[model samples]
Target chain A: MKIIVCVKQTLDTNASIEIKDGAIHAPGSARIMNPYDEFAVEEAVRIKENQPDTDITLITLGGENSRDILKTGLAMGADRAVHIIDSDLDDFDGLAIARKLYEVIKDREFDLVLCGRQAVDQDRAQVGPALSVLLDIPAITVVTKIDFSEDYSRVVATRQIEGGAERIESPLPLLATCQKGLNTPRLPSLKGIMAARKKEVVEITDLPNTAGSVENDAKLRILELSLPPQRKSAIMLEGQPLDMAKELAQALREKEKVL
Target chain B: MTDKSSIFVWIECQGEQIKPVSLEALHCGLQLSESSGQKVCAVLFCGSKVPDLSPLSDFAPHSLKVFSHGRWQDHNSQAVSSTFFKMIQEQSPRLILLPASNHGKELGALLSGLAQAPLASDCIEVECLGENDFKVKRPIYSGKAYASLALEGAGLHIITLRPNVFRGESGSATVLPEADINTTEPESLSLIVREVIKEAGKIDVTEARVVVSGGLGMQGPENFGLLEDLASVLGGTVGASRPVVDNGWRDYSNQVGQTGRSVSPDLYIACGISGAVQHIAGMSGSKCIVAINKDPNAAIFSVAQYGIVGDALEIVPLLTAEFKKILNG
Candidate 1:
């Protein structure tokens, strides 16, 4: 089975972003492989582990910062990586990014494609579904559990809805956005990291639409950025814990109107 | 088919009832209609029987488009989008508004891909710029910052409004026309839903008006009873930070943060959780936040409107008791 796992390097969820002078700022913060994407990569590797003949190719679209995530995918046991180097990708919306990926993977052969349900940074769960539409394939989104038939021609996937879980069956050449509760991702061991350095990492930058010094091809344009109003410090009622609790209740009822 | 001046609101129904988020999105569409003279249209893909749409009468959408097929009886967004895309191509409505629910977001993406439309997801504010242009304000990089996006040009635009925000009230009841869409499920509808396991009666964290969340400071799963008690009295649901969820102390559903569900409750009470930026990103959009922790410098305090320094095990119970007495009266 040939599988494709889409990965994205996202703003570390732990990093603080600031808006200074109408621009986003996150000084000295880290960028990590989107945490949800790890589950996708891990699931791919586990399938490879169970079926040694299975080959996993990790594909990512981003600027230079994204290559690091592809390397991480390699350390997580993907066989090879494809890095579509485009600086303008960060400015592109989900559909545009999916179009870029489609440009690369449209002709490739794969039985399954997996990715995170949504990148936490942007919090838009659009790419996987859009990619499925662009690729003209079936997509079972927010899949919590997955099982493949012995022949690898069919799949049974579980996804969570508002009040229930639904098990769906689909054929091969399917796309799924993996959700949490799937499996715990393994940390990269020392040997795997050393071996990953020798693994293949291909870089491609010749896409005509996304070439250098080009305008953002996104349909939506960002006009301005501002921070949500800052919250003032709470009035610390410094008597007894019981009294403070009473005061808090009074505040909720009278001042906050929450009660 | 809806006209070019129609603002289509995709309404999601489960069996017979409309999701609250979908109704909220309709209210948003109605509000947009008021200013731009755009007609409000509701779209639903349902089973054999449609839900009680009289509730939608209060919102007074101009038209309700119903598309039904046996395949839509189950949860299949691809089939649903496949049908909706045809309408998009025919009508080319001015705008499409959806609730930022998991299903709504995915459907928005698929339709946008099919039509090459611009989509602003999780938007808190969407305004008409006149002449088929729109301006939308949504949080980006999580809730750390907000981006105002301008959807210009003559092409159709889509906005998935965030729930619990965009306060719009229902208007007088009006005659709602039912547009019949006679369409069969495409042969591409290959996925089949075999079973559905319901987790009954528990309010999802995203849908909760109030959220009482715990973190590492709770010590163990045993201490979660304190939070559960507090949540029960507050009429809220329980949420947890990553550390507790990672520790196997809580189910992943209760987890809130990056990688977990993003929520924007009216009130969020953080107990014992140190505010990691990841955790804060999921919940900072909440209207009011109260943080209780032993450490005065816990990061969660920064995003909170109120802060109290004390042992969560003790403070949580006291607050629950206080709320019970105050609210009961």
Candidate 2:
């Protein structure tokens, strides 16, 4: 089976963020591979582990900083890596991204394409599904579990539903956006890291629009981005914590109107 | 003409009722249709029956179409795909808006594949750019930056709207002309839902207005009670970091961050949390942020408006007590 895992480098979630002059300031913070994408890479590599000849390619559309994320994938044992380098493409929307990616993977033969459900930062959560549409391939989204039959021609995937989960089966050459808890992504081992240095890491640029639709436009614009308002420190009372709690509860139930 | 009529918004139904996020999508859909001067419609599948459409009266949709499943009691991608395929063929709505929920995401992706339409997901905002073109904006880089996009292609444009970004507008309950409540049985039936182990007795962090979360600095599971007390005092829910959840100090459902649930509460208070980027991605959109940590340089304080650099065990109790006095009095 040939598998492709889409990975993205994301901002460190815990960085102390500052909005200065209408720009977000997240300096000196460490960046990491999107945790969700780790699951995608792990799953792809796991399938490769089960089938020794499986060719796993990790692809990312990002800047130099994204290398950290792709390296982690290589360290996790992906066979090859591809980085589409374009500085002007910093803010490509999911539609634009899907278009760019579809161009690269359209002719490639693959049994499965895996992506993290959503990148943590923007959380738009649209690329995998949109890619499926662009590719005209079936997609199993938010898949919590996936199992292939002996022939590796069909897949039975379990996905989260409204209150429960649903199991669906689809043919190969499909897309699946992996959700967390599907499998525990393994950590990069020392041997794997040394081997990753010798593996294939291809760099491509100026990939043309393969979809042939200049339909590249966005419907939403951020008028302004600002930090949320600060909260006032709580004022401590003198009574017993439990009694004060009851009074607080009554106030919430009565004055606040939840009751 | 703007091709304004025959707009369809996929209403994600939860059992017999529609999800609130779906209503938010309708609110967004109405705006898009109005800007482009088009009529709007709400599409659903036949089940128990469509719930109260009262919440969506604002957009004043020109139609409500219930595509039935004949006898199937659940939602299948192929069944929905075939139904939507038929609806699009009939109505030829220029734009189809879907909620970016798990189900909506799955079905929308699958439907777009079947129908061979353009699909966009997790869109935060949308505006009509030109004739049959829409500009969409969404946060990228873990909410650290933003991106703008344009969708221009063939006849049908399928897009998913992020929840919370479009607050549901309470519309006057008005009914509209109905479409076919049709049904179809899919061919793929390889598995069945054996049991649904619901994550019970816990508030959904994503939907909660106020959230108070803890992290490794919380010490241990026993120390979480103080945070819970604070949450109860504020009539809010409790959240935890990945470590806390992994250490069995909290349930995975209560975990908030990149690997967990993404939330946009009105207020998010971090007690003893160091504020990892993974954790912040989930709650950074909160309207208000308060960080209480012993270390003055804890990463959370960088984004926090008010910082209380002290022991959370000591401070959370006092903070809870203070809220009791102010909110109660």
Q: Name the best candidate (by TM-score).
A: 1
Error of 1 at B112 (Å): 1.4
TM-score of 2: 0.78
Q: Give per-model CA RMSD.
A: 2.9, 5.1
The CAPRI classification for model 1 reads as medium
**Per-model TM-score versus the true fold:** 0.94, 0.78
Q: Who wins the DockQ comparison?
A: 1
Note the B-chain TM-score for every model. 0.94, 0.85
> Runs in model 1 with CA error above 4 Å?
A20-22, A208-218, B173-188
lDDT of 2: 0.71
